[model samples]
Target: MTLIEIMLVLGLIAMLSIGSLQGWREHQQRARLEQQAQMLRIYLSGLQAQSYQYNLSHLLWTIVGKSGCVGSGIKPADCASAGDSLFKPTAPDITVGVYSEKTMGFYGLRNMAQAGHITLTNAAGTIRVILSARGRIRLCSEGKSIAGMAVC
Candidate 1:
């Protein structure tokens, strides 16, 4: 092949590779966010089950920073400090948040008395794992559509 033709082909391949790399990176980030949301949803369901199985009213589920902690009693700080530890994301450049109607603690009951959600954020996007007082769990993109599907 001519040198000029070879160079042109190489340049085209490089451009295509760059675009593919970018798309692959974005897809990876999206998958990570989705996995994080699913993990948080599982944790919430586990907490609800623990509450029901043990029939304890003081077992409070609290999230501090990226950490989720559940402890007996009303103090979130105590929960964070002394409560059973839940999973936290170990990935860099990611943030996890928890929000609840009752910020302090939710009484452990078969039926939740309050609702809350957990959000995971990264450069690619954000996703939410919701916890309802009626003991429901859901996953969705936070305030935005992912690819085309609405946040659940």
Candidate 2:
């Protein structure tokens, strides 16, 4: 091929490579966020099961932008220092927040004591860890849906 034709072909290939790389990076970020959300869901579900198995109440207390803890007790303050440290997102850009009308992250196995949700967000998207009043724990995506997660 002529020199000009060769350069044109190389430029096109470079453009395609850059586009694919950007897409791959976005996909990776989405997967990371989804994985984190699923992990939180499983952890909360385990806590719920433990509460039922032991016939006691469990508490998951969270500090926005910080961390969370899981413990068994009547009050969050009591569980704060004694509770096991819950998982925090290793992704530095992700932010976490807790939301509820009554209280924050109280799980009683028997009845509907409280309902709350924890949200995880980053540049890629947002995922919410929902705790229903009926003691159901689920994960859903906000803004854009992630693979295997419901849209909120």
Candidate 3:
């Protein structure tokens, strides 16, 4: 091939590789966000199950921030007291928000008075970990569809 033709072919390959790399990065970020959301869901579900098994009322409180802890307590102060807590520190390129009810108590054989949700957001999309009043935990994507998850 001529020198000019060879340069054109190389440019095309470079462009394609750059595009593929960008797409791969986005996919990886979305996967990380989804993983964080799923982890929070599992933690909350386990807490609920624990409450039922022990037949005791358990309180859950979370702060909305890049780094925060989900702790068992009637007050935010209890989060620092420590005992059965999930502490998340600066998840990779993701922002987290807890909406509606910040403090919830799970009592055996009693239904929640209101529902709450935690939102995990990245450039790729947003996922909500919702806890229903009936004590159901579910994940739904918002604004963008995520693989293996339902759209909100």
Report the number of clashing residue pairs per model.
0, 0, 0
Highest lDDT against the true fold, candidate: 3
- Candidate 2 lDDT over residue span 1-152, tens digit each: 99999999999999999999999999988888888888788877777776677766666566566343333344354324554546667676677876765564544446443677888887788898888878878888887788767888
Alpha carbon deviation, residue 28, candidate 3 (Å):
0.5
Provide the global lDDT of candidate 2 against the true structure: 0.71
Q: Quick one: ranking by TM-score, best first?
A: 3, 2, 1
- What TM value does model 1 have? 0.77
Tens digits of per-residue lDDT for model 1, 34-84 = 776677667666766777677755344544554443333445553335544
Top TM-score hit:
3
Q: Assess candidate 2 and give its TM-score to the true structure.
A: 0.83
**Estimated TM-score per prediction?**
0.77, 0.83, 0.85
Candidates 1 and 2, the one with greater TM-score = 2
